[model samples]
Target: MNGAPSTVWFDRKRIAPNVPEDLESIDPMCEEIGKVIQLEVDQGIPRNKIIVGGFSMGGCLALHVAYRFQQEIAGVFALSSFLNDNSKVYKDLASSDCRRPPLFQCHGKVDPLVLYEWGESTKDLLIKAGVMCQFHSYPRLYHEMNKDELDKLQAWIDQTLTSS
Candidate 1:
């Protein structure tokens, strides 16, 4: 329901093999996503109604895309992800002329993979940079979404899409 009103889902068939050897090749994946989003806009989708968001690795990609092409998207919602090249990307975010979206970040306190600290750190950086961001931390849940998180996201999207 979160992606219902102006639901333009951006997806790619395969982004390499998700292996360490193929990690560097993921740039194509990012390009694919950018193409999809651009295709939608070229076809006449208004930029502000487009939201860039995803889960885990996709979440990270969403944030990167939002930062890189901020003027092209309306907002971003990231779940359990990280900004890997912190110095470069974070600095870009800080200095870029891109408009900060109404960003939402959700993470589990017990996330073992990316760790809760990653989310916390990103949240802090975003906040420090004056982004319109909302962060929610789930207690005891691991590196994934819980039902409550889904519900809140649903509500947030509903409110955002329906209102001016």
Candidate 2:
């Protein structure tokens, strides 16, 4: 979300494999996220003490922000999200010197909106890029969050924050 709540973090007519991404809008949102990181740093929060995350489209955006713009963060947790190869994040993540933070990604096995395979592939790509990733799948879940996911996310966040 920008300064408002949203289903996806940015505007997209729809999701398709071949359509060129809307970087015209996406860049500004990423910059906004960067600003938040800077604001937190200015408040004396160490880069490693800050984490970025979200759900669905939000989850995808969080990954972009953490892996691409704010790599020094403590960690990232994405629930049912994926990224395409065209985005700047994909390019940035491919860099050899990129810092890969710990990631906790959870997906629903039967999610119809954001397919489970997409989430798995994203996690796998991050792992192959040398990101420390912890992935979880919920049986028969759709495109929504549940108590169990929240609990596990909380535990992961606590462990990450404490360890860092």
For candidate 1, write residues 1-164 as lDDT tens digits: 33345322333222222312222444555677788888888999877778878987778777767776554567889998666534234666678766777788899999887778877787787777767788899889897788899998888787766652
TM-scores, all candidates, are 0.77, 0.89
Clash pairs, candidate 2, are none
Candidate 1 deviant stretches above 4 angstroms: 1-27, 85-87
Alpha-carbon RMSD, each predicted model: 8.1, 3.5
Per-residue lDDT for 55-122 in model 2, tens only? 88788788878877788899998998877646566667776587888999999999998888878877
lDDT for 125 in candidate 1 is: 78
